[model samples]
Target: MSRPFRSVLYIPASKERALEKARELAADAIIFDLEDAVAPDEKVAARATLSRFLAEVDYGPRLRIVRINGFDTEWGRGDALHFGALAGVDAILVPKVDGPADLDAVAALTGKPLWAMLETAKGMLNAGAIAGHGRLEGMVMGTNDLAKELGSRFRADRMPLQPALGLCLLAAKAEGRVIVDGVYNAFKDEAGLRAECEQGRDMGFDGKTLVHPLQLPVANEIFAPSPDEVTLARRQIAAYAEARAAGQGVAVLDGKIVENLHVAGAEAVLAKAEAIAALAE
Candidate 1:
């Protein structure tokens, strides 16, 4: 089973305090942000700080993805070359990836698995090619930038962002890569955050990228398979097994048909639950 990324928190690499504090957080993954979080003047120093921190400290079980500056920026190439072969880094997240060509540029600098930030209109349009890139392992929604690019207003349901979100999501799924939802800006609002987490979970996001530690519990709880879901999955699997034993193609479970497809989904739910359980250990 794949690792669960239910709560991915972004920690500014320039802040020693934030990096130290992140070691204790229950987030499934940590994005050591080297892009927007760092100031232009501090960018160079932040890289050294992050490299030293990763070498000296241990962030167990959780993934360590470094989000490098976009190739459009002067610092982008340096960021990639610096963190590309860094020991603790798990993946290199390339921001504003417009197509596989963008991945190609970064791939030349690093042999590490890549993650793309699908924020631009052109990136969203070329999502399929980007997601299919051999080195790409995941996709992250950059909603704030995408909104700015579209000159769109924020709605409670994020209706304006649906098309872009769906396009990237479909592309990621088609290519069998993990896709996470964007951060909800109002980090302090627990109710609003929970609502959005539920939406992302229902929309098939592997997780939600978080802005603050306060948002972790809600995202983790909402994204994880619920107790009822686990129970239902167990029942479905049992029913399907019994049907197959009887040389039947489908089984009736709680008035619904359970076929091989349903069993496959049920297995995935159980596998995810198991994976989440293991993450806690």
Candidate 2:
């Protein structure tokens, strides 16, 4: 069963306070981040801090994901090597993944689900091959790094980033892997965040990766099935079933043709709704 990825909050592993606060947060997943969030001076200590905390704490309901540094980095190998019998880790998020070989290297080091961050120019170009890797369970957009690599300024619409975003989305969908939209840097702009989350959903992303707990409510609300959507899903399923029983090949709902493909989509919406409801319990 795939758990909800909506509102995945990233907390710096070096920050003891943030880690403790995460236990009570409403995020569907908590990413204990050792990369990007931690400075060069605190890399080793952060890893140790994270390991020690994970060993003792029980962060129930929140999916425990650890975003380790790249394998090519000095801290990466040691981070992967010292799994240290820690419990409650659900996945290992590897940053700057260029291709399948990067996943292979990290997959060999840990038995956890591998999530690749497609950030670089090369990674975007190789998204198809990377998503096809057997160890890969998801793809995370690293738009900050990608924009820096591309030398493009961030726009409200993300017009320049759309092509790369589309490629990653298509790649992940092709392989049936979870793919999440990158964080919005403007943490204070609630309206802007809402707009971006809506865009991501329309593009078929599973969720939006978040940087702050304040972003959680919007992400969860936007990604989950709306009440109207759930109602429409139920209606579509019922209409389709009735049509099939009456020896009809198709059903019409809201004046549009509903086919087997549409029914499958409706079922998926209901499944996600049920899964979210179960998680709340």
Candidate 3:
């Protein structure tokens, strides 16, 4: 089954305390951040600290991703080389990726799968190419930086960001790549976070990136399949199977018709639900 990415938490690589605490967090994935989270003076030291922690730690079933500095910065190349060589990292997140060329540059240095951060206007325009890149395993919406570039005002509903978000979503879906929503900055506002997480979930995001561990429960709960959804999915699958057995083209589920396409979607939901359950175990 495809792994669930309901809550992808970002932990600054420089903080050993945070790293230790992360192993116990309920995040489906952990992003050991070596980019914006690290200070200029701490860049080199942060790498060593993260390296040591990774070597000594066991993060269980949680997917471990390393967000390296961009090659535009002096530390970016070194971060890539270091983490790319490490076996603990599942994928290397390349920040501010404008197109496939950015992924190609890093692909040369690392054999690991890449995740692109679509933060710039250029990146949004070339989302298709980036998402379809051979080495790219996922796409991350870098909404904060994208807003800065667009000079767009903040809306609780993210109105200004919808077009960009939709474009990236379509790109990821078309290429069958996993795309996660951007961080919800207000970690203290659980109500706001739930609203945004629901929005992302409705928009077909695989998950939501998190800035703080406190946000995990909300994202996790919001993204996972609901009990009602699971129940409906099982019923749809059973009805379809029974209809197929009797040589019918379609089956009625509730008041609506259940076709092969509906069964496919229902199976996907159950697959995701099972994956989440496996992760919990």
Candidate 4:
């Protein structure tokens, strides 16, 4: 089944309480972060904590990913080297990926699928090559770092980030890789998060990366197909089928013509809804 990545939550490996709480979180996937979320002194210990937990506990139906430090860093190489032994991990998410070479290095160290972080300007330029990597499964936006690199402030409309985000999205989609949007930093602000989530959805992101558990419900809701959307999709498909049966060239639903393209889009909505339902199960 195609997994629903509508809400991917990042949990700090150094925090025992947060890690414990993650087990019951409703996020579609869990990124047990050993990189940005952990302090320098705690990197090694965080790795051990995450490794032990993965080997022992089950995260239920959610996809379990581990975000390691950059390969250029001391801790990054160690994280990749030991991931093969970390049972129950679904994939290895590498931070600050600039090109295919970064992914190639990590792939050599472990056999798991690699998820590259599309954060740096250099990475944005080489997105196609990064997404085209044989072992790459998806790309995650690193908005905070990207914003810093671009020297742009956070605007609710995200005008400054559009070009870069679009380039990354196009590269990922062109290669059939699943691409998720970057996180909304204000974890405590539901109104802001909802607006940003809606924007991300409208812009074609499969999902949004989240920082806190409190943001999960909003992200999950914003990304998933709504009841009205599912209804329209079903109606469109049925109308098209009925038209085809009667030897008509086109079908009309709610006064709009439904073509082959419309049917395909409708089918995709239903497929996504079904996938979300599977995750709930």
Each prediction's number of clashing residue pairs: 0, 0, 0, 0
User: Which ten-residue region of model 1 has the weakest summed lDDT?
Assistant: 1-10
Predicted candidate 2 versus true structure: per-residue lDDT over 143-207, tens digit per residue: 99999999998788999999999999999999999999999988999999999999999999999
lDDT tens digits, residues 1-281, model 3?
A: 39999999999999999999999999998899999999999999999999999999999999899999999999999989999999889999999999899999999999999999999999999999998899999888999999999999999999999999999999999999999999999999999999999999999999999999889999999999999999999999999999999999999988899999999999999999999999878
Best by lDDT: 3
Q: What would you estimate as the lDDT of candidate 1? A: 0.94
lDDT of 1 by residue, 1-281 (tens): 29998999999999999999998999999999999899999999999999999998899899999999999899999989989989899999999888999999999999999999999999999999999999999999999999999999999899999999999999999999999999999999999999999999999999999999999999999999999999999999999999999999999999999999988999999999999999888
Relative to the true structure, how large is the alpha-carbon lDDT of every model? Answer: 0.94, 0.90, 0.95, 0.91
Clashing pairs in 1: none
Order of models, best lDDT first? 3, 1, 4, 2
Measured against the true structure, the TM-scores of the candidates, in listed sequence, are: 0.99, 0.98, 0.99, 0.98
Please give, for residues 153-266, the per-residue lDDT of candidate 4 as tens digits.
989999999999999989988999989999999999999999999999998899999999999999999999999999999999999999999999799999999999999989
lDDT of 3: 0.95
Each prediction's RMSD over C-alphas, in Å, is 0.8, 1.1, 0.8, 1.0
Q: Which stretches of candidate 4 lie over 4 Å from their true place?
A: none
Q: Which ten residues in a row have the lowest lDDT in candidate 4?
A: 80-89
Superposed by TM-score, candidate 3 places the C-alpha of residue 221 at a distance from the truth, in angstroms, of: 0.7
| TM-score of model 1 (CA atoms) | 0.99
